[model samples]
Target: MTGATTSVELRAHNRVRLLRAVHDCGAGRTRSQLTRDLGLARGTASVLVAGLAEDELLHEEPAAGRARGRPTQIPGPHPRGPVALAVDVREDAWELAECELGGRTTVLEVGPHDGTPEGALAPLGEAVAAHRRRLGHRVAGVGVALAGPVRPGGLVDIGHLGWRSVDVPLLLGLGPGTPIAVGNDTAFAALAEARRGRLRGVRVGLHLHVDFDVGGVLVVDGRPLQGAGGMGAEFGHMPLGGGDRPCACGAVGCWGMDVGANALLRHVGLAYGGGRGRAQAEHVLATSEEAVAAGARALGRGVAALVNAHDPEVVTLSGLGAELRERAGEALVAACEPGLMSIRRDRPPLIESSALGWRGALLGAMESVFDAFLTIEGLELWRRNRGDGGPDTPERQNVTNSTFAEDNSI
Candidate 1:
């Protein structure tokens, strides 16, 4: 390629590296710190920052003057840019937040819903439209966090929503070309925690978000393990109780029926009757403590079984039931102890409350959009901007590693 093209390609690569560094930081990184972090020259960092600022992907603010040094600009959430829209659909309500490139989120809308498929889509569409109107043409993509399994093409099968293989994308009236990614709410929340919250550096971990329903995700080496056909980590539906109470998934005694927030509400409602709302249900009282303890035991049992099978290093819990982490943290740990075999009893995985709180799912939804925008395809687009020939392609051929090995030496 030409010299100009090479320069452009290099710049694009540097910009992408910088963005990745910022994302990896999770909290925010200073420009000088980023320059050192990415091993780029100051001039190159300035150019990359300028280009990204022009693209509305970054905003710069003057750092607080301290000690004796030249003042620097700190990078923060950009006001203008391709904003990510995250929608969390719950059994009783829905929440929508607008997230910028750097993972900053602003709640735009949230309200109650009937939990029906159509009811879910209407408010979601309105939220997206409102955000689009405010953002104008800078809106990049929409990511939906559903309470149940979502197929590859954005079809959601939520028993609580009375939805069976419903196409959420089509119902939301999004254009064909617009990018939309749907994920299980718990899985996405797990992704968010792994990427930006407490689960960072955990090679193997499980994240459970107990809300209106019990949902969870298995993360191994920073990637959410999506099973064949994109449905994975349905930990809640796993059989736990004896063959008595029927579950929403048509199974008997599923773990979710006894452990999720809905279950806690039901437990309280049965005793109090029609008096428990979100606040009342989440209240930390003696009865609430007992209910939470029961849920914790069920969660511990499920987690222990998962540990024996997957051998994760840790498991984090979030959502309404996470408050129980403070009250029943030890009980949860103790309950998990019996499920382990003799050899593995020496090192049981730690169970902790999620650091990201309830926003984990929303943040994870934003991450889905970020992944799409910062892919190899995006690199190809940057290459085109530089007029480079494009990436190198190699023929598919299996080569034995032994071919590269030197002869045996004494």
Candidate 2:
């Protein structure tokens, strides 16, 4: 009901900011560095860090080889600090990783499926439960990237998996107490590109994580332009100007139907399924010269169409699409030039492969999980983990019904 920014809340915000400033600094940050970087006074910065250390969220490590000046300790993630769980669920597999405040990630497991995404839920739940038991309350929050369209009220519709209106939190056995952040896989990949990879400095970048099909997000600033119900940009669903083939998404002529691994597989007459996608694409690229050229040409046409519609500063691709962009090379560029407007033909957006490679979705998911904890209520969560048993604000972010819109300063 309250729409006001409070004083206590302001302090909590600053506390989280200071913690993040150090966390984002990779290895760690010195006392003086934290002070200067966070714009906090020396004593104030020390006090804030002391508070975090007391809560076991951060710790001070000695400057081992420093020969001169005051030997200052750099702030680092406590061995038993709060860790965010990052999950990237594919059509037939899922990867779970633990990310620390200091940006180090440990892949806990990658479980495969039996062509049943619905059945995958049980194992996913068990894995999360196991991780929670191992990490205790330090298992802060979870960021999940789903290979499907997540509808309003957290309902997911994965056409490939034949899953509709799936409640992610309930299926994962994540009770109401656990804060869960969910996003489309490709959108989160674009987020990864923007924050940690090729789109790092590009303002109007478009990240297309081409796998089974081309799905991506258009980044305006640093945030992906989310659609209604958080379905993300859903670029793949756009009608192809070429194909009449039926899409797995229950549509005909979808760009997704004609311009991904499936398309590549079909172009060379290969059996279709999520399992054999990578192997099939690799085989065609490695063995068949004609198939490789044909696939790349198709990719070129699709990329050109998308670029003509959305003038992104850069287009970063992952998976087989990236390989196509590479192999296609000048043929792809020349194919796209005619599609571009006269002015844009001279300076088309750069098409490049993902710098983060396979880890992009995982890293982006972890970032979301971490951001869920960088809020007013999150202050109390950290305090509670440190055994500071006290009544606090509601265990929810200050903003309601929306993610990525409020306090994205991180």
Compose the digit string of candidate 2's lDDT tens values, residues 1-410.
22438956655666888877866666466878778876777777777878778878888888678988878888888887888888988776889999998679999999987646557777997898788766766766788888777765456777766787888878887655456777788877888778778898788988878777778778878778876557657878877437787766788787777666676777788887554466676777777666666666666667777777788889888866777777777766776677677877878888899998877788888888777776656667566445332112232232221232321111
lDDT of each residue in 1-410, candidate 1, tens digit only: 22235776667667767776776675377899988987889998898888777766677887776556676777765665556788887776778988877787889889787667787787788778666656554555678887788776677787654689898877887644455678888888888988887788999998888875577778988877878877877888887523256765777777777676566777766432111245556663235677788777777777778788888888888986577677787777777788877666898878888989988888888888777666535434333322122111111001111111111000
Instruction: Indicate the residue-level lDDT of 70 in model 1.
Output: 75
Residue 389 lDDT (model 1): 20
Positional deviation of residue 49's Cα in model 1 after best superposition, in angstroms: 1.5
lDDT of 2: 0.73
Where does candidate 2 have its weakest 10-residue lDDT segment? 401-410
| Residue clash pairs of candidate 1 | none
Worst 10 residues of 1 by lDDT: 401-410
